[model samples]
Structures are given as structure tokens and as C-alpha cells.
Target: MADSDQSSTDSPVDSREDSIQDSKLDKFSEDEETLITMMFNLVGERWSLIAGRIPGRTAEEIKKYWTSKYSSSE
Candidate 1:
């Protein structure tokens, strides 16, 4: 009973975070791939600099996206 109550309260916070991240990513999608490409080319893959231009996305997320996109497939 106590465990379930704690889980219920904690779940909403995690759900909210997921929704926030999704919304942020959605904003990036609106600008198209070209904008991101230009930023990356000029900024030199520096997430901190890129994040300034794109609101809501963090530096880490920027790096992660770049890695996943350019990573070599085996």
C-alpha cells in the first residue's frame, strides 16, 4: 500500500519530464534538418553553443543526436 502510493506520486514527475523532452525535440523538428546542419557545421559540433540557438534542448542531447546520426554502422 505505502509502496504503491510512493510509486504513484513519483510516476507523474517522470511522465512530465518525458513530455517536456518530447516537446523540446518537436521544436527542433520544426526548423528542418538544414538548420541543424548549418549550426553543426558552423559551431563545430559544440553542444553548448548550439543549445543557445535552440531553446529547450540541452548540450548533452545535442551531442547524443550528433553521435547517433554520424556513428558508423557495422
Candidate 2:
């Protein structure tokens, strides 16, 4: 009886961990998609010239800001 109870408890804990992993994976994919779109919008635009204005700003930082700002609305 003790072994059976332990097995049942462990199963749910494992499943919950899997759920968290899946959620994180989904968020990462969504962030990548948003970043790609933002990059396309900036292509051949004047933004490229001003990119250096924000010293040390990287593509990842730009993507994260836009994702946090825009993705929530979507």
C-alpha cells in the first residue's frame, strides 16, 4: 500500500513538471516569432542608422522589450 501511494504521488509531480516545461517552450517560440517580425519591419528602414544610437542594445534586448510590450496585448 505504501509503494502504491508513492507511485501515485510521483506521477502527478512528474506531470506538473512536464506542464511547466511545455509552457516555457511555448513562450520561447512566441518570442522568436515576434522578434523575426520586428526585424522584418526594420529592414531597409532608417532604424538601422539609429540602431547605434542606443549603445549596447542588442537584437535580443529589442526582441525582449517588444515581446513583453506587444505580446501581452496579442
Candidate 3:
């Protein structure tokens, strides 16, 4: 039915939005921050490598956190 089709299409979009919201709401813990620093020192901006070491984190999220915390604004 059309209603079922519409609901199925909406499900993916809703889940994607929920995941985005969840990622935004989540903060890096102290241990995660320490791990990120250590990984950066070892790999030097290889975000995917660092992300592989951290559970439940993506490379993009790691890079954004690192840049926001460490990169100068000049």
C-alpha cells in the first residue's frame, strides 16, 4: 500500500536524523580526549586511523573535535 511505502521511506530519514542529533549531543569524555591526543601524536592527522582505535566514533567527528580543540584561529 501507499501508506506502507511512505512509512518505509520515512523510517530511514528519521533514523538518519536521529543519529545526527545523537552525535551532536554526545561529548568526548576525558579518556577519549586523551586517546585522541595520543593518536594524533602518533599518526599526525590520520583521522581514520585514529577513529579505528576509538569505539563508536567516526573520522569526521574526531577531526572536528581535534580542530576545534587544538587548531589556532589566526
Candidate 4:
């Protein structure tokens, strides 16, 4: 039925949104934070490379976290 087709189409999008939300909620473990800091020092804003060093972390998330935690407010 059309309803079933619509639900199927919506399922993947819903799951993707759920994953995004989950990632946003996920906190960086201490090891992850330390690794990110060390990697940033080594790589200097090459976020994708930094992300490669940290498991389950996206470049965007690492970049956002670093900027919020480390960037100067002034």
C-alpha cells in the first residue's frame, strides 16, 4: 500500500536523524578528548585526519568540540 511505501521511504531518513541526534548527545570520553588534543597538535586542524585517529568520531564533531572547548572567546 501507499502507506507502507511511505513508511519505508521515511525509515532511512528517520534512522539517519536518530543517529545524528545520538552523536550530538554522545560525550567524548577522556581518552577521546586526550587523543583529539594530541592529534590536533600534530595535525593542526586537519579534522578528517584527526577523526581518523579517533574511532566513531566524525570530523565535523571533532572540529566543533575543539572549537568550542579551545578557541579563544576574545
Q: How far is 3's C-alpha from truth in model 4 (Å)?
A: 1.6
Give the per-residue lDDT digits (tens) of candidate 1, residues 1-74: 99999988998999999888755554558473465678889978787888777766678777766676677687
For residue 22, give model 1's deviation from the true position in Å: 7.4
Ranked by TM-score from best down, the candidates are: 4, 3, 1, 2
- Please provide, for model 2 over 15-49, each residue's C-alpha lDDT reduced to its tens digit, 9 standing for 90 to 100: 99988754544454564555445654776333333
Q: On residues 1-74, what C-alpha lDDT tens digit does candidate 4 reach at each position?
A: 99999989898999999888666735889899989989888879999999998877789888888887888878
**Model 1: how far residue 66 lies from native, Å:** 1.4
State the number of backbone clashes in model 1. 0
TM-score of 3: 0.67
lDDT of each: 0.73, 0.54, 0.87, 0.86
Worst 10 residues of 4 by lDDT: 18-27
User: Which stretches of candidate 3 lie above 4 Å from their native place?
Assistant: 1-26
**Each model's TM-score, in the order given?**
0.60, 0.33, 0.67, 0.67
Instruction: State each model's C-alpha RMSD to the native.
Output: 3.6, 10.7, 3.2, 3.2
Write model 3 residue lDDT over 1-74, tens digit each, in one string.
99999989998999999888557635898899999999999989999999999998889889888887788878
Query: Higher-lDDT candidate among 1 and 4?
Result: 4
TM-score between model 2 and native: 0.33
Winner by lDDT between candidate 4 and candidate 2: 4
